[model samples]
Target: MTLAAPIDPLAGAPGAYRDDLVEVVRTRHVPIGAIRTDSFAFWTDHDRVHLAHDLPAERIDNDLAGLVAAELFAPGWLEGSELFERLMTGLVVSAADDPLSAWTLFYRNTMDRLAQLTSLRPGAATEPHHGALVEGSLAGYAPVYRHAAGLIEPGSVLELGSCFGFFSLFAADRFAMTASDLSANTVRLLGRVAPLLGRRIETVICDAARVPRPDTSYDTVVALHLLEHLPAEHGAAVVTEMQRLARRRVVVAVPFEDEPTAAYGHVRVFTARTLIEIAIASGWSWTVHEHHGGWLVLDRP
Candidate 1:
């Protein structure tokens, strides 16, 4: 099925879409018959679509929920039944055996939504659905970006585990920014899109725990929404790395869920107390607080 926007090369080619889905079937050793196609090729049974891979179901659900939530911010496109079907379709497609395909799809859709949102005339009236998709997706995380931006010190900044690099793009005007992620594909995509958006962001492919930078390499080091996806020991190591790489301050943010959200690939939860513990462990002057989520800010001597 055709997407709302044409799939460009950056947005996986039409052939790449088919090959990726086939690769998913091959990797999972699932029967080719399980694959179904419409808007996307997904694994399904005669009854309904199924997650036919080893990826965490909770993580996939979280990603799909973000897409579905966008619909809620601006209703009327699809009724209840149709929305449910859309959500299920997204889940199965996202849960396919190939994670790179899922990330590519997310990048394409997010860029498309943001493009539609930004193309609007300032203060101009438009249809409810025009920018609703992006607005809904940004609702939860925009505040986190704003808060992180506020805490940023003077001079250059590095964001580890930058994912899609949206926060880096948001703060590009105020600071020299560098976005780093473990996935080279994500970094490459961000590198391509940053210039297209008229922003100068340096993108790097590096692990957060062992970033190849000298001590105090950047004025500020930020890791928003990245810790929950790591184990306790690894999270601490990242904190140490952040401290080692920052001259001014190290900022860390995590969602305050009762339990980790599997759909987001979160392996643990963090609270105000937990953040305080992290701060104390760092042996630095620090502040722990919450707004959209828990935050731990460590000031360098």
Candidate 2:
């Protein structure tokens, strides 16, 4: 379930453990995005999309929109869509008639479209970058943080390297959490679109090596795809920083795919054995779990 030194698994995987394709989920109520929820598929006076997971609007399509979004922005998501333009206009009209509905509408629509984007699932790594990097939205690289209940708490969240702040926004909007990223441009772009989605994100540009705050600031800290970017030693240091900031838990996921491909970006590639050793040496009370593309999740105390 892990890789050791001498063979760092996170190294930009060649042939990325994932397949190179874009997947998306569709629903009726959703004009052109994934099905939102299990409510009646209908639009209100304010022009909103609502639908549950059954009935005429049964839960059918659920593709890789989030993943694609993540991949589009090189680990980020695009908030600058025509949809937002329309939503903002609606918000002005709905603000007076239905303020509560107005805000929820923003969140619902934002999350809905966000879900449509691609995920980092199984193939983004091996695929050619091409035009995917434009618009700063990776349509196919969403990290599955749904299971990380602790990370989604309505509290402060400190992410080590929020490449594009996609996961950070997911945590903040869905769970009332706040997110911070290390990249200035990433933070700015994320900030511009955050308010439109009815979410608030506080990003700080700092070296992942030393986050401004100490450990225990955030309920959960996630370094989803960051490890692979640094040399083994720096990657470990980033893990240490995440642990210090996470008051409750630290979650890490790394790619498991083979190397020599265009997607793998790590200086060293790891095998199963070394993966475990690195987790331990990094000072994370680690537990490796199964992740897409043969990646591993190490949980720390």
Candidate 3:
């Protein structure tokens, strides 16, 4: 299936696009404020609460508690109590030792919960798809997350096309993580879901092709599984924008042409050579020797 926009039709949207209720902010600097988009307010401010503080410690439990707790500060945030309990209880059965295992469980479980509440399927824009397909797409990018964790320098981190905000939450442990997506609803989903799971991630609505931030604003910029969804020339434009926004390195990942996969809304396939060519043309100096999940690591230094 071919799409001009490369947007997934079955990826479980929260509700009718509520531009007003979709955007929420809670920080020391800004008060809990919102604006109504069209007419109806889909949700209320009470839905967004300090979940960790309001709910008992026992209620907020998960297999990744030991690994994720250290990164989250007290008075942690969350969107819904019912959803939180349901998600944590669902994950208690998994006994994975690795940190990545727990993260994967959290991501999949939350996605499942969203799928149930909405009429979201997994397939082409016109067809109904299954949950396993979406889960596979999520897991396919694990190597990119692992590689970025090791190479990321000490500074602010900005992840373009940060679908689900899992890596952004993971990177938040080491750096100030900011996640951006073209859709406000997508960013809003991360902003709501991250805090509920006791993960700290700052969400923003912006286009990867034209981020509003200034040049050299972040130490590292990452775009994973996003290039394949764009035309080669458009992908290059995003790479150029990533270079402008990044000070040290711009790490990107697309599906390796050799791997067998089925991903929705993926427009173009990329190989190591083609990705490297784009990186070189974008003025990146050093290429990290290590490659995982078809990662193209381009460092300016």
Candidate 4:
């Protein structure tokens, strides 16, 4: 049976936008089945799976409709099992593309949706699907951005493991932001997009554990939602590296998850105790607290 079409957030987008998306899907090399796994799933596909397991077939059908409504899957692309496979294949390829142009397209779509959502009149009716897409894209990160912003010290800041550099962009007006990440694609995307967004932020492609900058290079160093993606020892090394790079303070944040959310590529779980242990091991004047997640703030002498 064919699934009903969901609202298209990109319905009126320029022809070029649709062309770009189609090109990305056409050129994708990886198969969807090859990328689907028990442990790691695409964030967009997470609802179809439950705790690292696929939901029952009936549930998945329901979930796929939800995904379509959220704009994670294209409208009318769920008419058959083959189209569903195409949808997943497009998502997997778009995420893994080294140039990251596909990911950029997705980002642009979300931003456009957000703009439309915000332009509505007070008490205006919002399409539930658009609301879901906007919420899924920004809701989790917005509070964390505000929390981290409150803790950051005045002066220059360096953010390690800055995937997509969204936090860096969020705080750019308040700080001299430099966002570094291990992925060249992400760094490149950030460098290209920051100016377009009216933000001035520097981008560096480097490992967080071994940044090339000299000691005391910035007044504040941040590693938000980053440690959980690294091994324990590597995370510790990154903490030490943050100290070496900051003259004033080091800030770290991790989700308080019972188990890592592999869809986001999280490899380990962290709690308040683990954050406190990290602070103690650093031997810095530190404060540990929970906001949306666990945070360890280390003040330098």
Off by over 4 Å in 2: 1-113, 116-143, 147-155, 260-266, 282-284, 293-301
Task: Note each model's CA RMSD in angstroms.
Answer: 10.2, 15.8, 15.9, 11.3
lDDT: the better of candidates 2 and 3: 3
lDDT of 4 by residue, 1-301 (tens): 4453431222222211111112122222334553333222332242231111232222221123235323323333223332343343233233323323433454454444444544454335665441253312344455667778889878999999997677787788899999999877558767876777677999889999999999999999999889988998999899999999999999998888887744445689987888888888887899999877889999986
Residues 9-101 of candidate 2: C-alpha lDDT, one tens digit per residue: 111221111111111112233455532332222223232322212222111111222222333322322233322222222222222223333
Candidate number of the best TM-score = 1
Alpha-carbon deviation at 229 in model 4, angstroms? 0.5
Which of candidates 1 and 2 reaches a greater TM-score?
Answer: 1
Each candidate structure's TM-score, on Cα atoms with residue i matched to residue i, is 0.66, 0.52, 0.56, 0.64
User: Over 4 Å off in model 4, which ranges?
Assistant: 1-137
lDDT of 1 by residue, 155-178 (tens): 999999997787787778899999
Per-model CA lDDT versus the true structure = 0.64, 0.46, 0.53, 0.62
